[model samples]
Target: MRILHIIHSIDPRSGGPSHALRGLVQEQVRRGHQVSILTTNAQSAEPWMPDDQFRERMNNDPAFSGAELFIARGYGRTRPVARFTWTPQAYRWLRRRLADLDARPDIVHIHGVFSHLTTFAPRLARRFGVPYIMRPAGTFAPRCMALGRTAMKRWFTTLFVAKDLRLAAAVQATTPAEKDELREQFGLNNVVVIPHGVAGVKDAQTDAPAARRALNIPERAKVLLYLSRLTPKKRPDWVIQAASKLLSEYPDLFTIFAGPDAGAESQLAAAIASSGLNGQVKRFGFVTGDQKRQLFEAADVLVLPSQSENFGVVVVEAMAHRLPVVVTPGVASHIYVDASGCGLTVEDSVDALTDGIKKILQADKTELGQRGREYVRQHLTWIVVSEKISEVYAAIIRNQRTRRRNRSVNQQIRLTTK
Candidate 1:
């Protein structure tokens, strides 16, 4: 099958959606399907482009070798002065390009919503009578709209997104929580639950001591890592507070908050200093690629106290590394962790987070980490996810063919009756 993915941006720091796209494309390519990506050339002031380590991995990683990227200029910013990812020129170019393709895509997979692509891509698919799937990437959840943008969202949905979503062959959500949110908001029953997949990292399997040496993490210190975007929604401050609470008991505990600071680093630093958790809490803004793998290996445990996470990609990444996780109520994977005994799920509070951390530390950590690793290997790898996604694509195409066949038969019957 020939598949084309349309996303606002491919920058990894754009968050889970971008990474999820990479995983899906890699798996699809490995499965012998032709896959290509159409993405915006949006560059945020912050770093998201692959660093030296990531470039090296991409060069050697066979999964990434076949996935091709076509970058076009885009405009419009989610934040003031950020990269323009939804430009008019890009939208026009895409429409023209799709029209001109010699071999039209079997399926057009659109990722992210409330962007120019979201508004335009689906219309093009409908115009060409091509089946397309829309993955909102958790944008429809209530928490995502609660930041004083409800009115604009409602207006946008009514005018543009609603028609596209209703006309879509399928709508995909990465978690059950997201599926529910979409159903409630859109009253649509077509939502399918499909979680994002993680590519296995061999560096994650490296010995902890060696990994620590590589990352310059002291072997004696029990590292608690917070790996995600430094955004207000992620509640990075909560991790700092939780670490403060555990400092008395585990004096050697060192917590590092790493990831691209999406305008939240200053506040996080302020909180760390005010709590006098300066030494214990360090903000290593934006680590990715091999640096990300080494950090995962060096860490004893991972914490993501998010206010709302449709699906926590970093959680599974940590799990894949054989590291236990501490996720808050907002994370959709809380239920999985609770059921698998891989980690603890706590409320989105400092006290609860602190207790959850303590519990994981006291338990058989090695066993817990192993359970996490096994869980990811069995259920969350790209190979497994891609297989399911392929089924979705095949079903959509088959249904389309059936509908067309029925129409043709009906026309023939009418001619005979006449």
Candidate 2:
């Protein structure tokens, strides 16, 4: 099937939604489907998501990067983030591109269109008379609003944006929690819960000692890595508090917070200082590409303390690296962690996270890592996700065919009666 993915930025550090799109595109192309991405990233003098290695790899990949790169202009001159979530160029580009394309797509799958790329794309897809699927990627959920800490943006979304999502043929959720969040809190009228997942790396094992040395990690210290954007939603404070508690009990524990500071960097930095963990906490500002993989390799466990996560994609990535994960209980990834025993699940608290890290330290790291890999292999591979997506696309096409047939039969009956 010919599929066009509408995304805000092709930049990888922009996070999971972008990563998921590129991965699926690669797989689809391998399966002999023509996959194209329409985005609104103009020629920036400086790298917009400079810290993202995944974005770098995707940009350089022989298969993925060779695809068309549509750069559009938008309203994000003043702030770094405004460029991503408020770019107005995305919708306009999608509308014009649809008209200009030589062959119409079987489906136009939209990802993260509500931010940076602008909000106009979904409405344009509706106008083109093509069935477009919106993957809010957990942006429209109640949890997202709380995480974002912006009541006004939440209100605007409820009034103007969510209706656009409802207008789409269907919305995609990465997990069951997200699906429920969409229906219950977001009042989503049409939705499908297809796991936005990752495949375990082939021979993903690494030279742990080398990775440690590159990161300057001490051999005696147990590495605790939190790799994601430094944001309030990520609840980095929980990790900091946990670190303070572990300092006395586990003196050799090294707490590393590595990722771009999207909005909450200063706040997290402040917390780290106030906690008086001057020597213990290591802030790597941001990591991408190979640096990211190496950090994962050096770590004993990955910690995601998100108060609200649709599906923590990094949980699977950590598993791929054969690292155990410690995640918040309410997240969609928690379901995977709890069921698979690949990692420990903790409640939303300082002591809870602290205990989780302590418990993880007790377990056999090798066994935990193996379990994590097994979990991803069973529940979250690209092949499994592709099959699910193909089923949804086929279902929509079949439904359209039935509706056309019914309309034709009614016309024939009217002619015969006349």
Candidate 3:
């Protein structure tokens, strides 16, 4: 069967969404399925988007040669970008290319609903009589709108998102929390919960001492690793104040905030200084591959402490590496950890985060990390996620075929009666 996946951009720093897409496309190709991707992020003769626009490069990109890549982009800054995603020029460009759509596709799986690729492509899928799947990721969260920095999205959704969401053959959710959110937001009941999986790195976990040595962390220093972006909605200030309170108690403990600094790095520095927690806080900016794995391995505990998170892919990634996690209240997996005893979840406040961190520091790392990795191995992984997604695609394709056949029969019957 022919399958097409659509996304607006391939920026790796965009994080899990692009990674998940790459993994899915690769697995489908491995399974001998015809898969292609339509992205507004294509490189024309001289690259489509400006060199500065793409903050990160997508490595081992499955969208490269095998997939039929079509480029698309929204003009202007990312904040007010959703309007540009569905601009008349982009819409016309897409319609023209889709006129010669490669295989007419059995299904189109859309990632990031607000992007140019999804905004216009879904309408095309609908017009071409194909099923389209919507994966909003965490964009449906209210705080997403707050962070989207867009008053335009509110109006855009009323016009496009609402209709596109309903017309979608099914909405793909990464967790039950997201499915519920979708149902509440758009009255969209046709939602499927299919959480993402991380392909874990073997021997990723490093002993605290060795990790500290590698990172130049002083001997006897305890590390609390925050392995994600420095973004406003993540509330890194909570982590800072929390670490400040725990500082005296855990004499050796130091906070390592790592990840690409989109905007919050200086704010974090200022917060740490104003809170009188200087020197105790260290910012590594962004570290991936070996550094990322070693940092997680070396930490005493993994702190997410997000105000609003969809699934917290980092939480599960930490689990896969057998690191105990302390997530903030709004993360979707907080309840899972709370129920399963995998780790702790608390409100996004300095006091609560501090307490949770201390609790994790005291917990049995061997047992807890072992349990966490076991649970992740049993439940999460790309193979399982891909299988579930495959099922969704198959069901959609089958339904479409059945509908076409039924319509044909009815047309024949009407003609006979005439």
Candidate 4:
């Protein structure tokens, strides 16, 4: 089957959705499907790279080389969040590219909403009589919609996104909580709950002492990692506040913020400095490859205090590394954590998060980590997730075939009667 993924950006720092897309694409390719991605070079402000440099890196990057990548120009860019455009050039590029495809894709999967990709790409797929699925990727969650520029988001959704949601073959929610949010709050049917997959665990054990030494973390320190963008919604400041509260109780605790800052660096820096927790709270910007692995190995626990997350893929990543997780209730994966008894779910508040961290720290760390690892192994690996998604694609195609057959039979009956 030929699968085309339409997304705003593929930059890893773009967070869970981008990482999920990369894993899905690679796994699908391995499973004998033709996969292609159409995306923009849109990136956030911090850790800035010139457009040409970024594009060159992407093109030459081995991970991206597995699938054909189409990078379109986005308009009206700003720091941290670049608005996707409906420029004439973009439309022309998409149309020409679709025309050039040797075979129309069996399915066009649009991976987030409120962008031109969500509003326009599905229509383009429709023009070629292809089915498309829209995965809002938690963008439409009730709390998620309440964040920055609410009025504009409402306008965009009403004017452009709602129609697409109604038109899509299915709207994917990564968890049952999200499914309920979409159905009850947004009145969306055809909602499918398929959680994102994690890359298989490469090696669960890292040389703990060596990793700690390399990262400059003291041997006696207990590491708590927050490994996502420093965006407002992610509530990195909450983690900082929580760390401040635990300073007296866990003096050796080191809370490292390790990800690209998506317009929240200054705020986080101030919070860390003023709270008198500078020595305890460290920021390591963005990490990948081996550096990322070492951090995971060195950490005793992973924390994601998001105000709203459709599916916290980082939680899965942490669990795969056999690191216990502490996540907020807003995270959809909190259900798995709760059910599997592998992590703690706290309210999205400083006190609640602080308490959760303390509880995990005092518990048997080895047992908790092992439980989380077992849960991920059972349910969150790429092969298992890709198979489920492939089933959905197959079902949609089969339904389309049946509809065409029924129409053909009706036409034949009319001709015979005439």
Give the winner by lDDT.
4
lDDT of each: 0.80, 0.75, 0.75, 0.83
Encode model 2's per-residue lDDT on 1-418: one tens digit a residue. Answer: 7788877666656667767877787677777777777765532223453334434544576547546555455556344455454655656567666777576677888886446453666666667667788887877556676554468677667766778777878888888777877788667768898886685466646778999898888877888999987777888878888888888878887888987766777888788888866687788855767888889888888999887777778888888778999998656778878877888888788788899998998899999888878877876888778888988988877776687799999999999999
Which has the higher lDDT value, candidate number 1 or candidate number 4? Answer: 4
Clashes of 4: 0
Candidate 3 displacement at residue 408 in angstroms? 1.0
Q: What is the TM-score ranking, best to worst?
A: 4, 1, 3, 2
Clashing pairs in 1: 75-87, 259-286
User: Residue 233 of candidate 4: its Cα lDDT?
Assistant: 84
lDDT of 3 by residue, 1-418 (tens): 7887777666655666776777677667767788776665433122234543542344234345465554544454544453245445557765664566564677888888665657777888788787889998888788777766467778778889889999899999988888888899899978999887777335544576776788887666777888877887787877888887887887667888887766687888788888665576677855767788778877878898787888777888888888888998788877657665778988767788889889889889878887778777767766777788889889988998899999999999999999
lDDT tens readout by residue for model 1, 1-418: 9898988776666788888888888778878998877766664436545444444444454545697666666655456323325567767766776787686788899998877766788998888778999998877778877854679778888999988888899999988888888888888888899898898644334578887788676788888999988889998888888888888898888888888887778888887887765576656666777788888888888999888888889998888888889999888777668766889998768899999999988888789988887888888888888889999999999998899999999999999999
TM-score attained by model 3: 0.89
Q: How well does each candidate superpose onto the true structure, as a TM-score?
A: 0.92, 0.88, 0.89, 0.95
* Ten contiguous residues with the weakest lDDT in model 3: 40-49
User: Each candidate's root-mean-square deviation in Å?
Assistant: 3.1, 3.5, 3.6, 1.9
Q: Per-prediction count of colliding residue pairs?
A: 2, 7, 5, 0
Q: Any runs in candidate 3 off by more than 4 Å, and if so which?
A: 42-68, 82-102, 147-151, 200-208, 275-278
After best superposition, candidate 3 residue 63: deviation in angstroms? 8.0
Give lDDT tens digits, candidate 4, residues 1-418: 9888988877887888888998898798888888888888777545558989988887776666578887877775763246555444556666765676675688889999777766788788678668889998987777988887788888888888888888888888899988887888668878998999998866536577888889888878988899998888888888888888888988787888899878788888888887776587667877888889888888988999988888998888888888888999888888878877888998768888999999999999888878888888889899889889999999998887788899999999999999
